[model samples]
Target: MSQAADLPAEAPSARVLVDFDRVDLAYDDTGGNAIEDVSLTIREGEFVAVVGPSGCGKSTFMKLVSGLRPPSEGTVIVDGREVSGPIKIVGMAFQAPTLLPWRTAMDNLMLPLEIVEPYRSNLKQNRAEYEARARGLLKTVGLEGNEDKFPWQLSGGMQQRASICRALIHEPKLLLLDEPFGALDAFTREELWCVLRDLWMEKRFTVILVTHDLREATFLADTVYVMSRRPGRILVRKSIELPRPRDLEITYEERFTDIVLELREHIGRIRKA
Candidate 1:
């Protein structure tokens, strides 16, 4: 993984933002639980990465955070409020771009505004303003001038950028990214990392990224949590002490590799356990 230089100094205060207390989740009508005894707190505007082996409920955790799923036990609170159904404050992008084939890049970016509130009710009255917002977000993600193209016409990376734009169009306070770059090649994935990093730096949204890529987590997160296999208990919590405003070149440095290796060891231990 290549990283940028000019590491950022750590922020002074680490106040809590999202809190998970002894949380346990099991799908309705399913006999088994997906996550158990999960407890962690993410600081406001913090970048937290959750990494684990496959089927360790990393995606399930995303659902919980976004209030898409209710816990069978324990509590999930964001900003001191308990999370109920479908939090309006969350923006999500997933493994696949999942952009509608029928919509052009700009239209796809405007999808959320068509459904989510404040904008939903005013979409007709505020179409011009909304379109302008989507256009700005597209440019930020390097999707400039591709707005008129349909999803099929854009490359996978371009489509993913549009998807992220759709997610952020409403400007939610929390961003839930579930392996959004998993389908991309290494080069494209790194490129998107910088895209996401710059967006996060500028927006300061609380982000909880669920991924299996240790290097990706190291490069983009303020803190990384490793989960054990199966029940998906959080087994390790490692603070990435590296300086921020990180670029792609920093990933090649000794410090970056050290953190990745340390996380690799923790995940290896979980696999063996």
Candidate 2:
């Protein structure tokens, strides 16, 4: 794996934004935990990826971080506060675009502002300003001309782009992505990876991406964490020391391949356990 010394010397010192302290989650009284003994800290503006075999509670980690599910044991802290319910500082994009068919791409992007606080209250009063921001986000993700198009009118890649824009339109401090590119073809998925990479480079938002693709995790995250099966626990925390502003070409490099294979070995062991 690449070493931290490879990172730029000018990297900013970041405060811890999300902390899971010996967290465990049990969905039912059966007493079987979905995730157990998970402890990690994600610094503000850090991009972290969680990967494991199917049913390893990767998505459960996202739920805990976003406050959708409270842990049965331990605590989850976000932005200096313990998370008790759905948090306001997080934005999420999932495998499915989940865009409303009736709404144009621009309207879909504006949904967060229409529902989330502060913006929701002032939406009518500042509709023009909000729309301009939405348009800019769409343009940033290569959806400039497609803003007027409905979800059905856009291609799969385009719709995913719109989904990401919607997640960012409100500019949440933490962004959660759950296999956001899993549904796309290989080429399209790689393309969206670059789109997401550029967006993260520009905004530097804290991101927790739950993915099964080791290569995807290696390419996008500052750190990649591997989890155990069932009662998921952090097995490894691999810091990616590849210098920043990385392009897709770096994915083919020897170090990148080594990192991916190392993550793969962890997953293989967990699956065979």
Candidate 3:
């Protein structure tokens, strides 16, 4: 509900947060690019959503940003630094919760803190402080009392909350979510949407979410990008200027539907192409 400043009014020249300049990606033995000549810029603290057909390189884009795969040509830069390999400043979560079954919810949330940075080096000495932070995040996400339960004890939605808490435990600068709510039922998905919105509002971390849901993009992103079919390239760049602190009721508004329908039409055209 609080208003955080949106991305800068003008695009950054050298200070761009994330940039893909004529980026092309292909496997060594592949005959063509999975993503081709794609160029885009994401400013610091921006929430950008990418939508496209299956196998349209949405996942490939995530891999590229996380530095799991290097571009076959051109460049990718994040935080004014060239992406060379797996970036430590990035945290990721996907559709599946992927929580280790044996780990309790709080333990699941603490995984990143135990593995990353100053916390990792001081985990033994700072265990209590880190645990309190984890508990606080869980409470914020409505998972306060469930921290001691194992992943199997939680419902799909709760498990996903744990997964997101895990991703943010170390407080990375960039959050990469690849359809993190895709597997949940519609009601649960919407509930988590508010949870995610609140989290992003509180932290203001840059987010790159790859989702097939146009409504989700409209609800959460500052900008929505549509990609062409395989050998994917950005085909549309639409900005959503909807008033912030968006409620589920807003999805019923004409303005919201207009944006969703426009994005829908774009996706339909891509599917036919």
Candidate 4:
């Protein structure tokens, strides 16, 4: 059967890049589902954030999207195809920078090209081109002067920034961020949020960010989905209607706070349930 046959006819005809239809995941042969009845769709170039209480499967959701784990039931589709296993179309960044401490920032960014195909095979031949590309990405993320520095030489924010550059170096169609800035100081954390916002605005890659921070979700996502407690399900899908080119100043405004509060209420209700 065709993909269209999998859904109701009344559904909008917009292009959907990621679709999870009543998905579920189990860790063992007879274990209970980690997440159940999961269904959501994300379109190309859409910036989406997933927020939830602790142990609510927010990270599990990211894993499902990236094909890091197969669903015990239901379909996991992306870029118009079902995800059976890990695919090259995804770029992932976790809470820790996870950069190779021995390598320079520029070298770290180029790491993906060494592991991925086509680029990996041609890395030697395209040395200059790839180096330039790495340099360009470094510059884009404000890492120009520190490209030669090792991971430890960079601050937490800078290392995370480098991690993002590394993830994007392959130019994957989808970017998965799992609390990439959660470990940073408050000032640094917020600073990286704007950095991320600017990067998303410029690159337009599809993003599925799993974060605990409500304000971060409100500021960065075009649409934020709130998940319930374990066996997680989307409880709310709130669209961030704030205009683009957003700045830190916008976060203090009543409108932004209202949305954050609204999401918080939903979480509180989920917890209470």
Candidate 5:
């Protein structure tokens, strides 16, 4: 199988933001590894994607970065610090959106500010300021007028946009998206690709997205890491050399199709293995 390590130094020489050194994870003491020999570097402000088939430990990789699970072997470090527990500097959005049904879009975005701290501790004292930030974020994601609407009131696309806003409200250095667009319809999902692309262009926060969609990975990530089937590890790290800010139009180009096909070929091998 192809390997990312064989590729040129795709990551920048600036201070490494995330460093995984031959990492491995196992849930049960006697069970096999979920992921093994996974070492990679994610630089500051880079957008990276991790892709693999179902049950291939892609989600487990996210948990390891978030400090939700400890690696059974090797080091998992972020921003120069080994992730020992839940790191406050990381923000996450998932496939479900998981917005509180009772809250409005604006409230949902501000939820992070109320939960993650110094903002959390001072939320009450700075409610107006936080509300303004939420409103601005909503506007940025094209949910300006929908701020007062409940999650049920928004379409799948809008809700996902709000979820991303919530993740960014805390201004976390790293944003972890675990299949954030997986549940949307194809059209809506593509629309969100633009939404996310715009947001990332504006914010430039480091991102590590976990998804099964090769198209999504190619369009969004600066570097795409394909994982092997369980006992997963980084199989390929294809740097997306596409120019940005990339638009939906770029997706139709021959170059785009070639990259997707190349990645699909790798996945085909992983599945067969």
Candidate 6:
């Protein structure tokens, strides 16, 4: 892992990277807002998690941040700019790995660079450099020596690791994840948590994770936002103050369990309401 000094000197929390002010999003077919009066600020490099009842617009929030959906009202600002269309500075991964079946793991990781700007133009000239980067990222996620294998050849966890690497290969300023680990087995999911943790600690990019798992939120997020049922609203914003470079062992501690229970209670109340 790279030392902290390898990154910029600025404090990771020093700048506000995402701002949602009284935001509301409504679907015409649904005839009501999916998200309402949602207001929150996410600082640069902060790990934020959104948790709520099944239809509480947690995924809707991801869409807004990534510029996939426009708000019906209020502004959605990211990296100091009001989003007008799909922004280029964000990367996303979902519950599915979504790697191309025909492409090798290395080729899957290179897909974004082939489509996204600057790199796309320079790809032919910098192919070697990009391949080296892909290899490094694969190694980081324990996919070393598996670069030439096709997606179908890799395990579920390995495929997801490649999926995450593909999202990150572009080095975006913001990473949006919607239940990225929801499909994996419990042990693999926890292992990947540490993988993500190390990557974030090393790179200091902003992350917005939407998940149903309270323990995942509590264990990985700097702050966890609990939303109300439908027409979602921010019900609670709980900051996890546990020490950094968190280990899997911390999840077993009393403080960790308490925080998870608290988040669970908030969701339980929303579900019952």
Instruction: Give the TM-score comparing model 2 with the true structure, all chains together.
Output: 0.96
Residue-level lDDT for 229 in candidate 4? 92
Task: Provide TM-scores for the models.
Answer: 0.94, 0.96, 0.94, 0.93, 0.94, 0.95
> Can you write out model 1's per-residue Cα lDDT over 1-273, one digit (the tens) per residue?
212231223544466678999999976767778899999888778888999999999999998989988898999998779998888888899989999999899888888888889889999998998899888899999988998999999999988888888888999988999999999999999999999999988988888999989999999998888888867788887888888889888999999999999899888877787
Q: In candidate 4, which residue ranges exceed 4 Å CA deviation?
A: 1-13
Model 5 ranges off by over 4 Å: 1-13
Error of 3 at 245 (Å): 1.3
Best model per TM-score: 2
Worst 10-residue lDDT window for candidate 5 reads 4-13
Model 3 lDDT at residue 237: 85
Q: After superposition, how far is residue 115 of candidate 4 from its true place, in Å?
A: 1.1
Candidate 5 residues 1-273, lDDT tens each?
Answer: 344452323335466789999999987975999999999988888889999889999999999999999899999999889999998898999999899998888888887787788998999999998888888889988897898999999988898999999999989999999999999999999988888888888888899999999999999988899999988988888888888778888889999989999999999988887
Report the lDDT tens digits of candidate 6 across residue range 190-244: 9999999988888888889999898898888888888898899999888887788
Candidate 3 versus truth, CA RMSD in Å, comes to 3.9
Note the residue pairs that clash in candidate 3: none
lDDT for each of the candidates?
0.87, 0.89, 0.89, 0.87, 0.88, 0.89
lDDT of 4 by residue, 107-189 (tens): 89898999988899999999999999888888888888998999989988899999999999988999999999899999989
Q: After aligning candidate 2 to the native by TM-score, how far in Å is the CA of 77 from where it should be?
A: 0.4
Return whichever of 3 and 5 wins on lDDT: 3
| Weakest lDDT window of 10 consecutive positions for candidate 2 | 1-10
Pairs of colliding residues, candidate 5: none
| Candidate 2: stretches off by over 4 Å | 1-11
Cα lDDT for residue 272, model 6? 76
